[model samples]
Target: MDSSQRIYWTAFYTKPRNEKKAAERLTSKGFEVYCPTRTVLKQWSDRKKKVTEPVFTSYIFAKVDETSRLEILKDTSIVSNVRWLGKPAIIQEKEITEIKSFLEDFPRSELAHGDFQAGNKVQIDSGALSGQSGVIRRTQGNKAFLIIASLGLELYAEISLNHLKKVG
Candidate 1:
């Protein structure tokens, strides 16, 4: 296929609570769609049941070429493509594979919102300091400066914000 006809995995923002519907419609039209979801136990006033919901609220991914992208936007449930620098954000296949693998391993895992701020205690989730808890001294862009107390001394290190999770 030519470059214009090459398939790309692009993310789209959907109408509130319309992710599954959009995925269905797109698939029915012969477009490839992916909507990552998780099963959770939800409790109502008098009942509890397992419900599957989209992992990313109001978001779904579809594989489409440039020509079909216009057709995708015509769906009422799709608001618009997720954009970066005025262009549709293209998602890497490897990243999508990782997400699938992660969900398979931890089906009930919840996504944590990382709004790192100074003085918040967080635990390193990966890299050399994985599992170590530290207090954020400050944040700069995508990096967090942490003060890790160990062996009666405070050790300082800068870690990527992606590797840290807020600790309660």
Candidate 2:
């Protein structure tokens, strides 16, 4: 990457089960990559119980110097795409920090991601996930999983129930 150009986060397609592999390779080479994941239950044939695994599979966000875009994208195991307005998506470091903070602050059961079939639009007015907006996907018993989409990727990440509510 050229010194004058800036690094931006981008979405990549990885070989099945290759998300961790891609991240390891890029970060080891001095690139910043993010593969946000959460554990979910996977029902197996041989087991009566479920296994916890990644929510989003084979997808990651990477930051590459504008100059290194070409070289960095040459990995045969990963395919890349610019996600922000045709340019590589520049995810503010602060945003990632906030996400990390949220994970540490909230328990896994506190987040939810379901179809918003019956809820109100909401804006997270404050806290780590402030500025996020979504509709209540629904509640399972007493817990809720407010659904919000990452504007950059247009992909949804279930957020903390306490962070959202009816907007109007």
Candidate 3:
């Protein structure tokens, strides 16, 4: 296959509340799709229900080549492929594995908005997240919570102070 036809993971934006539907359709068409979701206890005045919600509200990842991307886009539930620098945003395999492993370890972790001062980038020099760079969302004493944005989605991970260093 030509370079443009080479397979890679790309993030797609789905219509509101259609993340699951989009993923299911893509998978049925033979595209590998990843839609990480978590079950949470949602409560109301009269009852509590366990609801499975997308980790990244309206986004899903799919493995497809540029040649088949148009087919994916034609799915009614999918709005568009996420773009980075005017091209389809490609997700690294390692990053995908890292996110999967992270969710497995911390299934209920919530995504947080990072408010680090401008120009601050933190990299984990050691630990499970070693070599990963992210923005520090918050800190408590000797621990820090990081927000990593990859493939158009944001994920949160907590690490000890010593494992992190300001790089850029």
What TM-score against the true fold does each predicted structure earn?
0.64, 0.52, 0.63
For model 2, the superposed segments whose C-alpha errors exceed 4 Å read 1-4, 48-52, 107-168
Give the TM-score comparing model 3 with the true structure, all chains together: 0.63
Give the C-alpha lDDT of model 1.
Answer: 0.88
Best by lDDT: 1
RMSD of each: 8.4, 10.8, 12.3
Off by over 4 Å in 1: 109-168
The per-residue C-alpha lDDT of model 3 at residue 27 equals 91
- Candidate 3 stretches greater than 4 Å from native: 109-168
lDDT of 1 at 153: 88
Pick the winner on lDDT between candidates 1 and 2.
Answer: 1
Q: Give one digit per residue, the lDDT tens place, for model 2 in 1-168.
A: 456476555577677887877778978888777776654333344532333333358777776676666666787668665466776666777777776687667645433433223466877766777887766666543235566767554434455444555576
Positional deviation of residue 15's Cα in model 3 after best superposition, in angstroms: 0.4
lDDT of 1 by residue, 35-70 (tens): 999976554667656679999999999988998888
lDDT (10s digit) by residue, model 3, range 50-160: 678899999999888987888899999988999999999999989889999988987653322222333358888897778888987767544678898877889888786
The deviation in Å at residue 83 for candidate 1 is 0.7
- For TM-score, the strongest prediction is 1
